[model samples]
Target chain A: MNKASSALSGLYLLLILFFLYIPIIVMMIMSFNRSELYLLPFEFDLVWYQQLAQNDQLIGAARNSIVIALVNTVIATTLGTLTALCFARYEFRGKRVLQGMLVPTLTMPWLITGTAMLMFFFWSGIGRGLHSILLGHVALSLPYVVIIVGARLRSLGVSMEEAAATLGANGWQTFWRVTAPLMAPGIVAAALFAFAISFDQFVISYFLAPVGTSTLPVQIYSAIRKGFTPEINAISTIIILASMVLMIGFARFSKFGGER
Target chain B: MTSSARRLRAIIGLSGPTALWLTVTVVLPLAAMLVFSFLTVVPVGGREAAFTLKHYTDFFTRPLYLTNAWRSVRLGLEVTFFCALIGYPAAYILAKAIKGRWREALLLLIVLPFWSNSLVRTFSWTMVLSDNGLLARTIHGILPFAPSFDLLYTYPAIVIGLVQSYLPYMILTCYISLQAIEDSLTEAAYSLGASRFDVFRRVILPLSLPGLIAGSVLTFVPVLGAFMEPRILGGQQAIMLGTLIENQFTASFNWPLGAALGFIMLAIVLLIMGLFYPVLKKHISVN
Candidate 1:
């Protein structure tokens, strides 16, 4: 009976995985297909990818995406790590309110947040473009970085810092020599998360990007809306693979599922 | 500097930058949106705008906005229902049935797609669901006489795409709750003459409610505000609150109406969240 039940569970899981992955797999396979209509018995070629390289618009958007994601990662990681350290180490007045402030970014729908950013920026003369997109992405990624790094800090405990202080290390010394190095893995993980969040961001970029300037996701969205093209398939395949590789790197540093 | 003064400075130095950034980007924007929602026009470029409730009033007086709002809510419920139905079982099996490395690997596999670009994933669904696409071709190859399986541009296609997009969140949350359940508790219930179903209903269900609620909220809120999936998959059928708001901003350039619609969606999301606050508070505190 147990064996039968286990078999049933395995089958159910396989079905779910198939559902989850088949669309992605189809997209990947179609990217290389020679036919524009995604014909079967696949004649595989890198023709679309070759075209994608020379497509100035797509390449420019991809560059914008990478640059924005990198800058957002640095800003979000540094600020988020510091804020998380504050939460972990110091109990200041209104700390609860400050922490509660992070919830809106996490819980509020991105559509609402994105539209609000557009309205506020347009009204306040902060007008839409890459800069506004950067602000939005950092805000969106800040909470995740804080949560991940804060969890790591909690697990690492305060004893290490105390131990360093007892050994006559000053505040800066203790932090740089002990705390930072110890928290390196978590910080790296958080940075990767911020990078992924900014890279994969769509709704915020969609609203904030001006005409003739957009991120990759925003560009791809317009491409999809305009028409189906194998070029889109090629770019999307690269995007998925890049993110998956980043996530696997994240999983190595952080326990994604749980403390195993 | 005095030690106490230095400690205060340290706290400020640590937390100030993020606090200021969040205030500028998140709090002020939301507050500005609230003000924008009440205006007749965007107050910019010497555009004289006046305060008005007409945008909010239109939501009630005009049946179009009201119906679209209802449609979005219905879509949220449908997507959340399907996610729960599919995700909870997989999470359960992963937590209770599967062993160590396989469980970890499977969880990663399930969640990896969620971190990828959602726009790309939704576009992939278009390829699969379009007429004479991969799905139809596969079906024809097997049955040889089945009618056309053109699932694109339909409500179900949107649901399927969204379900695929958001299912990982449900599983992750459910797995967190399910993995926390002690095996001895199940064994204890069994030894007490409780049947498997009874144990699951009484012990497992109650224990996992927090994750389930969190997952549902997480899924439902975004799905409520989703426009891209609907536009790409539902086509003409995609007239939810999200699409309406997108149209106002992008097509009609009516900022006031769009802001109003966005706040309405935000209110709905907050209302649902408030209803589940008790469960969420406990779960969050535990984490």
Candidate 2:
């Protein structure tokens, strides 16, 4: 009875994985198919990818996406790590409330956040463009960086920093020599996560992106809305692979699935 | 400097940038949106705007707005229900039935796609669900007599795409909580002559409720405010509070109405969270 039930549950898990992955797998497969119409006698070709290469709008948007994501990673990870440091080391008044402030951005739907940003940026003269997109992306990403790196910080405790201080190291010197190196893996993982959050972001980019400026996801959104093209499939497949690889690296560093 | 004074400086210095960033990006924007929702017109281009409760009142008086708001809430509940229904069992298997290395690997595989581009993933559903797309083609190939049917551009399509989009959240949350339930407890129950159904009902379900609630909140809130999925997949049937708000900004250029609609949506989300607060407090320790 036990063996039979276990086997049945295993089969169920496989089915769930299949459901989760089928659309993505189908998308990746369709990207390589030669037929523009997605008609399948299963002819394979790279024609769409070749066309994608020549697509300037998409290329420009992809460039904007990378630049914004890169900048967002640096800004969010630094600020978030510092805040996590404070949360870890200090006992301050209103610390809980300060931590609670992070929840709104994390939990509040991006649509509301996006529209609110749109209104504020427009009214406040920040205007809509690549810069506004960056502003929104960094806000959405900061909390995640804090949460992830903070998890790492909590695990490390104040022992190492306290040890350095006991050994007569100054604050800056201890941070530079000790804390920085120890936090490196978590920081890298957090940075990668921030990048993914920004790179894959759509709604905020959608609302904040002005006419003639867009991110890759924003551009891809418009492309899909304009109609389906196999070119989108090629780019999307590439994006999925890139993001998956990044997350796998994150898992390795963060021990995301937990230590064996 | 005194140690306490030095610590104060450090605290301010470390957290200041993030505080300012959130103020500019989140707190102020939300405040501005609230103000905008009350304004008579966009407070720009020399337009003289006055405070009015009309936008909030309009939600009560306008049937179209009311219908869409209802639709958005219903969509949230439906999607949340389906995600739980599908995700809980999968999480159960992963947490309990599976063991060790296989469990870790499978869990990673489940979460891997979720971190990727959601917009791209949503778009991918089109290829599989469109009338002449993969599913249909495969169906006809196997059974020539079957009528070609498209699941695309329908309510069910939006649900399917969203369920696929958010399923990992449910599984991941449920898995975390479920795995924390020690095997010894269930074994003890079994040895005490509890039936499989009884154990699940009395112990497992109650213990996993927090993950289930957390997952529901995670799934429901976004799906409630989702415009993109409905736009891409629902087509003509895409009108919801989300798309309505999008239209106010994008098409109608009615910022005030959109702002009002956005707050109403926020309120609904808060109401759900408030209702679930007691359970959430007891189970989930999100910091």
Give the candidate number with the greatest DockQ: 2
| lDDT (Cα, tens digit) per residue for candidate 2, span A159-245 | 999999999999899999999898999999999999999999999999999998899998999888887678999999999999999
Give TM-scores for every candidate, taking all chains together and pairing residue i with residue i. Answer: 0.98, 0.97
User: With candidate 1 superimposed using the best TM-score fit, by how many Å does residue B125's alpha carbon deviate from the native?
Assistant: 0.6
Which model scores highest in lDDT? 1
Query: How high is the CA lDDT of each candidate model?
Result: 0.92, 0.90
Candidate with best TM-score: 1
> What TM-score number comes out for model 1?
0.98
Q: Write the per-residue lDDT of candidate 1 for residues A137-166, one digit (tens) a residue.
A: 999999999988998999999898999999
What clash count goes with each model? 0, 0
Instruction: Give the fraction of reference interface contacts each candidate recovers.
Output: 0.77, 0.76
